[model samples]
Target: MFDSEIRYIISSGQRKKPICQNIVLLQQWLLEQGRCVVCGSFLTKGEKKPFGTGLKIICSCNQVYFYLPLANLYKRLSQNLYKL
Candidate 1:
């Protein structure tokens, strides 16, 4: 599901647009994944330390999503239908 959404966003524009540039957007993405937007950890991982993707996102009790590779993602819309 996530892949498709990402693909749609990238495919439609076909431009190198940063996937996210603010905290709100990041939190929304994490929330959709059932993760604590502030902590950036799966809610199912009870009592376990929130091992964030990197030290940058770690925060008190919750996480602050800082980075996601979606940025700079671009897809070429052209398809070379002709065969050599």
Candidate 2:
């Protein structure tokens, strides 16, 4: 999943600002890292799945979506979009 630095960012309540307005860039960064955007410890996401089920994203570490709002939004959107 996520790395130590990303975990710290997530835990510290400092997650602010969107990582990137352009989802494409965000996606690229995630694929490059090859981990989960949501911390490995996230309870609601289910299993030890490594981000993206059949969606366009491949989020990993590097603290891209430390902003919970953005991460959640992307996940939600991707889930919905994946169905289509």
- Find the candidate with the highest lDDT and give its number: 1
Candidate 1 C-alpha lDDT tens digits along 1-84: 776576434524674444554455666666566466655556445232222331123334643333233441211112241110
Tell me the tens digit of each residue's lDDT in model 2 across 53-81.
Answer: 43233233222322133334333233444
For candidate 2, report its TM-score: 0.21
For each candidate, what TM-score against the reference? Answer: 0.29, 0.21
Point out the worst 10-residue segment of candidate 2 by lDDT: 58-67
Task: Return the clash pairs for model 2, or none.
Answer: 35-60
> Residue 78 error for model 2, in Å?
2.4
Best by TM-score: 1
User: Cα deviation of 17 in candidate 2 (Å)?
Assistant: 9.9
- lDDT of candidate 2? 0.37
